[model samples]
Target: MLEVDGLTCRFGAKTAVDNASFSVQPGCFVGVIGRSGAGKSTLLRMINRLEKPTGGRILFEGVDVTALQGRDLRRWRARSAMIFQQFNLVGRLDVLTNVLMGRLAGVPQWRSLIQLWPQDDRAIAISALEQFDMMPMAAQRADQLSGGQQQRVAIARALVQQPDIILADEPIASLDPRNTRIVMDALLRINKHFGITVICNLHSLDLARTYCDRLIGMSAGRIVFDGVPAALTDTIARELYDLEAGEVMDETPDFVTGTLAPAFGTAAVA
Candidate 1:
């Protein structure tokens, strides 16, 4: 289990994440949603230790990860992988080599620095690519792939890390609708097939309801609602976005009130 106890982050007088607390069980797919500047990204960054917290602590399997430093911090990061809104692959490197970078935590520094990955690591990278139907592009430069394809390579990179948890921050915000579905489907596969815990930040309620087992709603850096998608009524959504009933996202009422989407990965992709 992962425990986020009273986690807080303040920039001068402004608190980006205000005393947030939550616990996630193993293999759960969670989506964090809120308007811009709601601290959705900040919370994920804190969980991954990409951003330091101002108060409270994060415990993974009973260890206080907030206090870890040096090699210990690096190891903790390796165990918890992060996928960004922008695909953070090396634009100059081949897809396979970018995936192999996930193994740098375990690879000898000298070998990694020299780009000399072992055969075992190379095989693992290839396997991850094959899982995403990206093996054919293994030799292609990351910059050459389309946005959806690049995100898949990014997912493959995260897979080779063999992480216990995957934290994705607005991963599909930049993709077209088709690519959005494809990326979301890939994330669902990681959570179900690999049994990896996934905490994703999303802007679309329909996508969150489709892909996540749980939804955490934030407003002004505070968690205002935490429950299953069906529990998120239109009133609660208004509070989340601080908007009138008619002013929320277009047709949000229909999606929230209508039948929830079948869990992704188990059902056929549209």
Candidate 2:
């Protein structure tokens, strides 16, 4: 289990994440949603140690990760893989090499720096690519793939880390709806098949509701709602986004109210 207690961050006088506390069970697909400055990204970054918390501590599998240093900290990060919105790839390198980079933590610095990955490491990277159905593009340059394909390559690289946890920070913000579904499905497969805990910051309510096992709604740097998607009533959504109930209902799918989408097309034409 991963536990975050009183997690907080500040930029000068402004507080980004305020007194946040939450727990994530293994294999849970959790989605964090909020407005632009709602501190969602800051919270995830703190968990990943990319951003430091001013207060509180994070405990992962009984270790206080916030206090880890040097090799200990490095080991923690190696086990907890992070995914980004930008699909951070070395565009100049081939896809297989990029995936092999995930093994850098295990391999010696000299070999990694010289780009001399061993056959075992190369085989593992290829397995990751096969899982993502990107083996055919293994020899292609990273920059040649589209945005969605790049993200898949990124996921394959993360898998090679053998991570216990995956933190995706607004991973699909740059993709269209179809690509979004593909990426979300990939995340689900990771969570279900590998039993890796996934904590993602999502921009779209529809995607979050459709994919996440639980929804965490934040407002003004605080979590306003945390529960299953079905329990997220119109009132709660309105409160989370500072909108009216009717407005929330209008924005969400009809299933939220146990209503069916009226069939049109040929029936309307007749």
Candidate 3:
């Protein structure tokens, strides 16, 4: 189990994440939802150790990981892979090489520096690309792909990390509606197939309701609601987003009452 005890992040006088506490069981799919600047991203960054916390502790299986440094911190980081909103890929590198970068922590420094990847590592990267149906584009440069394609490649790279948990910070924020469904489905597939826990930050209530088994709602850098999607009623959503009556409904009418289709009215996956 993953336990976060009173985690907090402060930038000067402003607290980005204020005493946030939660626990996640193994293999659970979680969604964090809130308006912009609610500290959802900061919470994920802190959990991944990308952002230093000012207070509290992060425990994995009862061991504190917040204070780890050097090699210990690098291992912890490898155990939880992050997929960003920007699709952070090396624009000049081939797709296969980008995916293979996930193995850098495991291979010898000299081997990586010399670009002499082991056959097993190369096989793993190829398998990940095939899993996402991007094997044909393995030799193409990352910058040549479209937004949806690039995001899929990004997911494939995360898969090669063999992480215990995937931290996706708005993975689909820039995609079209069809691409959104595709990316969300790919994340869902990874969670179900590999039993990897996924903690995703999402802006769409319908997508969160359809995909996540649990939801954590934040407001003003504080987690105000934590429960199953069904428990997130209209009133609670309003409080989470500080919306007035009918405003939440106006924003996501289908998801508010559980009427949205599972397919999300998107074109068939290509």
Candidate 4:
């Protein structure tokens, strides 16, 4: 459903992403992992057309995203939604209103700015909130909720758009273990149940392994490893992260526990 070819991005002299190429099928869930400054987030942004690529092409259902502009770009962008690490909610807006904003692309700005959403839009927003079990909090201000609740609200907002593809960047970075699980589980549920193509930039290897069907590892603005999580070896991981044999863990999440085994060997580290 999504195709990226020879994608490259640069900021003046620095290349943030280079020659990145990948394809995601419908209902596929993919995770991207890389160290800070490895360009994982850049890749996602480029895919969504939020960050224009210096070269290469991005095609969504046969349309060239790079060539889109004006109304076409706006409409195409509406088909894909993004979730951030920080819940980017209007602190003062009610939860329902926040979700309703997802429909802004389809609604007139005058109508949206005046908080005069159409009845159908309102209904869709409410249903999305219900999907996330945030309906009870619909009347509450965004600031009134906890971090996890806010994130779920953000997800509801995305769902309100009925996006074909979901792009999440470091979505679990700011949450605790429980919240992380909650957010990740919600994303997985949406992908599995609704068949929304999901591409996320993740920091937690365990979460990536447990939830994503495929993994792409990046280093120095280039893709280094792309395969199944179970196939990842200590040597490959070390090379991806630039760590020594025993310096990286194999079993534990977040490099907190587990020992590294011989290259490609099934040695559990705890």
What are the per-model C-alpha RMSD values against the true structure?
A: 4.7, 8.7, 5.3, 8.6
For model 1, residues 1-270, the per-residue Cα lDDT tens digits are: 999999999999999999999999999999998888999999999998999999999999999999999999988888899999998999999999999998888898999888999988898888888778898999999999999999989988887888999999999888887788778888887787768999999887777877799999998899989999889987788778775334435524222223323432312111
Model 3, position 157: C-alpha lDDT score: 82
Please write out the lDDT profile of model 4 over residues 1-270, one tens digit for every residue.
Answer: 798999999999999999999888899889998777899999998888899999999998899999999998887777889998888999999999999988989898899878989998888887777767798999999999999999999998887777899999998888887788778888887787678889999866667777899999999899989898998776687777775324324435533212322221111100
For 1-270, candidate 2 gives per-residue lDDT tens digits of 999999999999999999999999999999998767789999988998989999999999999999988888877887888888999999999999999887878898999888889888888888878777799999999999999999999988887888899999999889876677667778887777678899999766776787789999888888888999999876677777664334434544333312222321221111
Each candidate's clash count: 0, 0, 0, 3
Best by TM-score: 1
Compute the lDDT of residue 172 as modeled in candidate 4. 82
Worst lDDT 10-window in candidate 4: 261-270
TM-score between candidate 3 and the true structure: 0.90
The alpha-carbon lDDT assigned to residue 195 of candidate 4 equals: 80
By TM-score: ranked, best first: 1, 3, 4, 2
Clashes of 1: 0
Q: Give all TM-scores, in the order shown.
A: 0.91, 0.89, 0.90, 0.90
- Best candidate, lDDT: 1
Off by over 4 Å in 1: 244-248, 251-270
